[model samples]
Target: MRAVRSIKGRLGTAAALAVPLAAFATEASAHVKWFCAYDVAGQPRGLAEVLCADFEWLTGLALACLMLGCLAEGTPLGIALLNALDRVTTRIRTDTHLLVRVTLGFFFVSLWSLGGIILTPELTTDAAWIPWLQLGLAGLLISPRTTPLVGFGIVFLFAYATAQYGAFHLADYPVFLGVAAYLILTGLGISVLGLRPIDVVRWTAAITLMWASVEKWAYPHWTDPLIAAKPAMTMGASPELFMKAAGVIEFTLAFALIWTPLVRRTSAIILAGIFVSAVFEFGKVDAIGHSGIIVVLLAIAADDVRAAASRRQVVLAPAYYGAALAGFLALYYVGHALLFGGPAELTGMPVI
Candidate 1:
């Protein structure tokens, strides 16, 4: 009886650990391929179709849940969690050295050269000058004095690449580009408009995740092919259900970033782990695509923004922020559905 009880306890502990391990492992894994439509041959079929009718009701229910969760934030448990989070954030270290910046620059340049990082990697026009341009930018980023120029150049290149690919088709990756640009800008400079660059990187990174999360909710079917290919992603749950849960997890983490510095760092760490895991599945493109986000997460981890003891300012109260986020998501998803028919209608159809 004693041996049996010990075995049972061991099993229970394994089960508990497995749940979070699975969740973290799957974070952001079903990306790139999902946001846009694709054929069975793995060919791009253009923008993903948004099935409004299928998910509209679900979205509403999720919003209601969010509202309830937000209300709960005012309770003692929430306050305690927030206070604990503040303590963690206050202890983070934000000071970065020149070597880190130079290393990051070298890494990005190498990725660009390898054709890992770019908008619509498979679809870009074959141009000889692009590599040279990337190398030039990388060189510029090595110096503190030239970092801002390289930053602006990167912003332009990313924008140009997106425009070349047709902006509407690529969808949310541009948000990642914006984060990269900001990181470059701030890493080279002390501050932007009196705000620490790391702070801006934290906020922007959070926003990028939040924005990408909506696509999962709005177009779950976009990920159907991926789920079909990798059944393990479902982890025994229905594909639809898993997609919805994934979106909620991503959005909740992103929302947590705004709540406290501790939460921000925690979210960044989790997100970085997810991105790292994705590289194993998606290869070089995943690494290239997520490099900027990973860098931002690292910066957030290094940031040491402490809360003022005298006056703690809540940037946006949880309740109001949650409500506003819900409203914005509804508008964006519904509007997208109206403009472009849902996945069922657009499957195999080219956006252009």
Candidate 2:
């Protein structure tokens, strides 16, 4: 009996650490409630499985492909970016700002070409709209010389198109509207704030970071397995509802950071720390394939932080696959599944 008690104690201790780690990994907003299908191992109310991808899913794919290509051409892009940074860092080394702008223009043309090829019709039912909308966002993010009117026209045109098509769905409405509103409001906010061009770009990136962080916070249950009865893992499990609580913390921090300029950099760093720790603790062996963008975004956030501090801004570049977004995101979700098992099982819901 004494031996049995000792073994039980050790088992309990290990499980405790495992649960929270698992919960947080899959807890990110971008991945949350994304593609949960009826095939989901128990009978948790899975989303209706559609035959083809929706606009959002297609947009995500385009964003992914765009990022992948950018990473592939990392050397030139990085050099051009570095030169742009040099221009920003000081007044006069050489009058090569126009060259950097020209380099970015070429990148944009290449982006359009890539979007044409990679955003294939097979992936999305709403194929007509997806590339166009994503391409618009890409434009705003890339050009260091973009004006608010140019951005406004691009975003508004897409918004008008979506409205014309009446393609909005209940599940996607909030996020779509929210992101749209963010772009418009921020445009106005930048005008009011008298923000520089680079500042607008950085703020756009920062807001996205903040929103992504807030997403997980809003749906903490997606990650928490201890919100399970069997409690497969410890870190993702909750002895005292820690996952839910942490959700509150992350959500609050993300929101606070988005609205407050001074806190934005700090918020980006905090969010990055949270994501990196979550990845290390709970990400699975195959995480690299899926969650790569999130990781790269964090690294990009680091650049934003430094830029904000040094130059009071960051010149936004077009979206690119970045170093390892898929890998990182993939690891995170895999960890969530490995650690948590299934939502219905955790919650004691009868399996379908």
Candidate 3:
């Protein structure tokens, strides 16, 4: 009984803590590149600088939330939450593939209409064939028989963009590959490895968001001008602190997407809300760019089958979150250093 009460109390606390995090989440999903000046080749801030005291405190708080959330997963409240999610998402759950297809079809058609875009808004091209290719891909989405081909076309576009830009710049959008994989696997009626089509999309979306969160940490200065332009977005916090907190919140929620079923489903709902809110604040470019992942998150929220039934798995979630956090941070810093020379030196405080 005490254990049950403990879990309930922790769940309530976690829910309360989540409010402040969500308040800042709009900026977390707003594509910084769309509103800010960025250089793909420019050096990011050093890891030492990013891992400062404030960052450590935010990380600690995030970990606490993760622990509480994981513990809450075993409680009756968690099961109730999942049931509520399932009830709310009945329509989306019934038409998962249709949702993805229609969204992607609209997205591709919009891209075709826009013209001169490579894959995302920030990545532009002078090639005349790309818009027509987008149009062709949109046409392919008209039938499930040809949807897999649309997937292949998306892969080609991603590859072409990588060739035009560098791999590092393209890394910002691996969710494209996730969308492609979803289209391919769903159309073919097959699972790759052990994961279903939507499973692949869930994992990839988590990776994409986590990578973006790391970028916020490494290049917080890149978004300084953006915060300057839209001071209201900061909600009274200094831009520097806001960026750090946003990175932590975004990374933590992204990691939650891959956790036990209830945790991940709730996270998907929250992330989807964040992205949707960003679309409102950042407008059409945000909507167009984020359309694919938003569909994936919706699918994840509606997923009822894939789950961690083992209590032990839920208990170890914090450990997994910590290790994954460390691993991704290492990879982001080391990979950038290898690809784009060393980190930049800052003469003074970098937070504007």
Candidate 4:
């Protein structure tokens, strides 16, 4: 009994450490992309379309299963499955390599530079030099000695560029804020702060998803064009129904991230899977946009945190977090509509 108790104590500590790291892995708004719409005559006009590709129905099904699993995580069957996952991830956490970290850093930098993800609007054909600058940053990330500084620089530059597009518009893509937070936290985690990088990543992921979910609730019409383009997205339901359901699912999963360890990891897995599956349909842009989220998810999956108590120590109760998020969304959209006339008015910029 004493030996068993010791083992349990050690496992608890391991799980506590894992909680912070696992927190980092999650999808930034489930890898959704927004683009300006155009008229038949090729004139850039209308609100941006919330688009998805590559078996959206299947993705939805998977997310549903994930949600169900999260709800059942306290059950015996769920406990068994989570234990199995924990065992597998335990081996992985012990094997994290520097090469892998550098590679991920390089990939993100490349994506940013190539205009495959964030900054896509700013790094247009006219601004050729921007890509070159991003590429230079990518090169800097390849070295451990320089990774921290380069990461900070990248985040700062991204924030500056994002601000140029209009602070109000920034609310539309809250995932970029998550990305920026990840870069800053990772850099600080590596060099200056004792903060766990994965923890920072996880919080940003949750915050981004929760924030972006509001867009779906406040402006479901933004997704109408994407559903129209790919009728299969509706799965026989009306576009409005699909959009509302998707918004709820995304928001719930984001909330789950702060709920418990099993649910958080499971949500990250499902969210990452949805993002990855979309790459097959949306092509390079989807892949580039989601790469950072995927890498963070991978890190979370590999984390060996198994402590149940650590999950309870989170900042807010699930209900409180959900309510807070809803309140913020209400204020944001209502204020924007009152000021600009409608949410669609904010999307009047030209396609990049």
Estimate the TM-score of every prediction.
0.68, 0.36, 0.91, 0.68
Candidate 1: Cα lDDT at 212:
69
The CA lDDT at 180 in model 3 is: 94
Q: Tens digit of lDDT per residue, candidate 3, span 151-235? A: 9999999999999998988888899999999899988999988888888888888999899999998889998877878788889
Best by TM-score: 3
Name the 10 consecutive residues with the lowest summed lDDT in model 1.
Answer: 40-49
Models ranked on TM-score: 3, 1, 4, 2
Instruction: Point to the candidate with the largest lDDT.
Output: 3
Location of the lowest summed lDDT over 10 successive residues in candidate 2:
310-319
TM-score of 1: 0.68
Candidates in order have lDDT scores of 0.57, 0.36, 0.84, 0.55
Better of 2 and 4 by lDDT: 4
lDDT of 1 by residue, 1-352 (tens): 6654654575466457545744644634546452446432222222333334434455455445434434435454444544544445453443353534554575557656775335334545567677667778777766667766766776776777666754544455545455555656665665667766556666666666777677666556677767777787677877766776677667766665655554455556666677777778777666665666666676665554545321122433445456756764754544454445434333334444
- The residue-level lDDT of candidate 3 at 111 comes to 88
How good is model 2 by TM-score?
0.36
Poorest stretch of ten by lDDT in candidate 3: 343-352
- Tens-place lDDT digits, model 2, residues 150-243: 3454455445544543332121222223333334444455443555433444444444443343333334455544235435333554423443
Please list the Cα RMSD from the true structure of every candidate, rounded to 1 decimal place: 7.9, 18.0, 4.7, 9.4
Candidate 1 colliding pairs, count: 3
